[model samples]
Target: MVPEERDGRDHGEERERPRRARRPAPESKRPAPANRRAPAETRRPATTARSAARSAARQLRDLTGHDPESVTSVERQRDGGWLIGVEVLETHRIPDSTDILAEYRVEVDDDGELVSYRRARRYYRGRSEERT
Candidate 1:
């Protein structure tokens, strides 16, 4: 303690000064869990348009006994089913380049089960559908 000068601070008042509050410890910087699931709001359901399209393509190939050429469209129906349009080579000609093509509308359940299907249109491999 400094020698109290005649400036007159009573030594007893120095001991009465307010004590400072202790601060909390800082938060830990540990890494987050590796297996943490995505927030529910940000996650999408397992059944998606692409999967539905694949299911339709598989069903069409299996039913037609030929590999499907392409998936043209996929639509969700009001009945909770899916509607997919597929193109397939229906016939082979002497020249491999000349094949008959058919378009089918396939219906499937949400679980990817085949509900029904029908051929919507037919055309040659070299020609496109004529819009009327």
Candidate 2:
């Protein structure tokens, strides 16, 4: 075959040169260095004392009637459980005020189960009891 020329250039010379291979598209849009860590790797799971305290508070509220006046204090025990002190703020038809103004000692396990419960002390509604 005869070589053809256009504008004083040889078409055969252009065809003889090798064309560049096309590159593959990048696997991800984000740059490699910035996207290296997965979402789970970047963030740590959270645990806190406040979360435990709040959980204990919710448990106490559920066990006792949702009476704001009933619960006096809540404390976390050394064994990772809860110690809740509840006051008998009001009672219906009980003759002795001591029976009405009792203090309930509630023990809750780490999983918020009622481990044990009892009336620790009784006092008159209008008077304090002397400890012996």
Candidate 3:
């Protein structure tokens, strides 16, 4: 067998191999630095009652498949969330007064995301309630 010569060194010589450069580990494999904290919800707060009402109504419509006709009431809850009353037309009739309407009580978080909702009441459009 013939001897192999590399860099003027015989095959029998003990030469150190050149080290290969290491690449940075992928982002997922690296541990997070101690100074970095997990991200918190950074959504903007719904400041005005009108905006909160709109948000609640939109969210209710998306969930229930009924478009809200009006915002009946808006109240701030003790937990900093909002309680919104929305009116939706459930059924149409020849006479507008005979149309069926439903009131939904929708609760939304401070960030305008709906957390819960329910049909609070239902009645005909022309029906009048006595407030005593």
lDDT scores for all predictions? 0.78, 0.58, 0.83
lDDT of 1: 0.78
In model 3, pairs of residues that clash are: none
- TM-scores for all predictions: 0.60, 0.41, 0.62
Candidate 1: stretches off by over 4 Å: 1-46, 94-97, 130-132
Better of 1 and 2 by TM-score: 1
lDDT per residue as tens, model 1, 13-130: 6466799997765564444468886675554544577888899889778887967989989888866678999888888786765678788899988778888999998887766664
For model 3, the run of ten residues with the poorest summed lDDT: 38-47
Candidate 1 colliding pairs, count: 0
Best by lDDT: 3
Regions of candidate 3 where Cα sits further than 4 Å from its true position:
1-46, 130-132
Query: Taking the tens digit of each residue's C-alpha lDDT, what string does model 3 give over 1-132?
Result: 997546865667688999999999999778778888555444234456778899999898888888799999999886878999999988888789888889999998887888899998888888835211
For model 2, state the Cα shift of residue 23 in Å: 29
Number of clashing pairs per prediction, in order = 0, 0, 0
